[model samples]
Target: MAKHIIAVGAIYIDTILTLPHFPAEDEKLRASKYVRRRGGNCGNAFEVLQQLVEDDIKLHLISVFPNRASADYAFIRDSFKVSVDLSLSIHRDNSQVASSCYVFKSQETDSRTIVNYTELKDMQCHEFIDAVCKLSPAQDAFEGWFHFEGRTPDTLVECVKELRLIPQYSGFKISVELENPSRVGLELVAAEADAVFFSRAWAEARGFKSAVECLKQNMAATKEHALLCCTWGAAGASAVQKDGGEGIWCSVPAWKPELENQSVVDTVGAGDTFIAGMLCGHCCQTSCWSLEQKLKYATDLAGRKVYEEGFAELS
Candidate 1:
């Protein structure tokens, strides 16, 4: 049987407004066009992975959103390519889904400013624990690799601890994205995660000149069984693994899309797409392959994702 993969995080309804140029302070500007779509880190990751993996592995999503037979639910249900357990999703009568308005001012550079309208109530520690526990039946514990956004430190840590208590899940791999590594109480979460992904800026902010150095400097946080990966926009990606009681570091250059006559339309959710590719590669590829090979394949997928506007067009 193929290994099961689950991703948990927030999902948002995105409203993108394309402007001719950035507006000055107190200045009014007209938008060239606008679009609405499903977004969020895990949301995009799930969408893209569905297209890439097909039936090679089982994909599942756990998230919090407004529950109802509304547009939000309809959009997600239609876009999701796998079975979803939305019982954990909080619901409000006639509630609006969590939405974001992004102003893309690409007249100069590919940049966007987001204004978020959060509606999904933050899950409490007990609520999160209950939701995770409900995923597995009484007869058997859920057995799969879990990837989640590291947003709520207290709840996330508690969830990890509770899941580890299951005898069958003792060896389960849990990966977390360090989207905001600088946040308080995240070090504890990072130490517990089996895999940690860092943005290039996050690594440099910690006084490391490169991703490999960043991983080496934080070896204490990463246990002997853990691995770390960092993505540099055009510079490519690098990884560090704890294998055979030694630290192995590998760097791979970014795939060149420009050479292929492709222009980058937008960079939104590119990192999430890369993560999705890595997850697919991990479950589908043989373990005999080196970490370097895996990173190269993921980087190539990310490069291609940039050529399109959103993950929906990955196919």
Candidate 2:
């Protein structure tokens, strides 16, 4: 049987505003439309994974949320059909949970933002214990893979350790993306993962000379683990194996409605969607496609996801 995916990451609710043209200083313009979607950097990845993979390839989204996060969180869990017994982590707090509002522009202009909520910084240890207790009924305690997005290294590593100590586990697989991975965290994760993915445009915006250089730096820092990948939006994606071998390259597949030509409903979750597609292929074991072929599967899904308006309401 195909192994399921156990995704660990964040989740959030996003409010998006689409505008015809961006507003200038002291200029107010009419908005084209507004949308609300289930998202969290971590949550969107799992959503994308479920849409791209098989029904048997289960997803476990390990994440944090505030006390009042039940409604939004439940919707995503039921929609994705993931086994959340072991992956969902709840943090109780008196404060309001974090949410992001994006103002998307049609032309070349900046969109203003209003909603500002604090990120989850603290989570109770007891919740982690409770989450593990729920995993007792799963078919395989570790039959799935691990995925982490924006999860703190210290906290996640502790969870990793705890899971490793469990005697009932079968096999565990993992792929991770660091929304804000520190040098130390990245080094630790890269060394332990089956595959690691990076977005070139996002990296470039943050001022890394080139994606290749960044991967090389990361690989050099990592002593173990092979299969490091870099996803270039329209350009495509590439992966580098360990032993300092030559790299493999693949073009990002074109979507049904070209993302460039199609109306970009919202771009926030596109990257997360891309990662979900890539991870799905790995988890399925049904994909005989080469590395590039596997990655294109993901890129195509991400392109389709953005054209649609929200966190892919996959049919």
Candidate 3:
């Protein structure tokens, strides 16, 4: 049998209010649209993973899904066929969860705001592993890559440590630490993973501009295998393999010749989509692929996914 992929990250409710123009400070300007998109790094991973693995693999998403309110916060749990082990991640507070508010009309141009509406409480990752351990490994239930959207919160780190202790099996047990906003960054987690993926936005945010710089810094610092990457806008992606191979760049040009009609609704989750493609390539044992190949396919899928309004919309 094949190993499974585990996606872990924060899940939240997104309140998106689009205005024809950027809102002025304290000025009431509501001339546009309003909508809600699932706004969690963990949530975004599910959108990408399910689209790629729902029909073929036994994917599991570990997150906090509070049933305190009548709202169906756990919508994806039922919508997608994957097992959503919510015991560890779901916050029990009835109060509304905090969210990221985005205002944008262009891919590179836009502003986002984060507001903490409720006291953030999440499950201890040990709690998460304990839940998974309940499932019989003899039944071949829990084993595979554990991909985390971001790294923070001591609980999750504990969870990662425990997962590493599981008896050696055919599973990869990996974690995707998408550049986290936390001060502790992925460097700590890098040494613990079989693979670490980085996107241009996250890479730049970390003050490492190019993929080469990112790779050099992380590879030197982390002993665990790491694949430093930068998702170039329209140009595609640049990736450095963990085996100390030379860095490679791939081009994923715009979908159409016309930029105005590119159908780009939002670039919010493109990075996550790209990760999905790369994960697919790795999980499926794609042979000796040029780095450009991964970039092209990842960009194509991510670019297309943005045309939809939210993190993901099935066509």
Pick the TM-score winner.
1
Per-candidate Cα lDDT values, in order, are 0.74, 0.60, 0.60
Name the top lDDT candidate.
1
Q: Which residue pairs of candidate 1 clash?
A: none
The TM-score values for the models, in the order shown, are 0.90, 0.77, 0.81
Sum up the clashes in candidate 2.
Answer: 7
Backbone clashes counted, model 1: 0
For model 3, the superposed segments whose C-alpha errors exceed 4 Å read 72-118, 136-143, 168-170, 244-263, 285-291, 311-315
Instruction: Output the lDDT of residue 84, model 3.
Output: 45
lDDT of 1 by residue, 135-248 (tens): 555566444688978778777888777777767566568998877546567667778888888877677767778777777777777767688888888988888888756577
Q: How would you encode candidate 3's per-residue C-alpha lDDT over 1-315 as one tens digit per residue?
A: 545666776666666665566656897765466666666666676677676654445566666665545354544344444354443344556644443444344223454444534345566766677656654354554445667766463555566677767664335657565555454645666666666776666777878766657666776664444565666566556666666554433444634434575555666767777777777666654576666676566667777777777655532
Give the clash total for candidate 3: 7
Among all windows of ten consecutive residues in candidate 1, which has the lowest summed lDDT?
82-91
Pick the winner on lDDT between candidates 1 and 2: 1
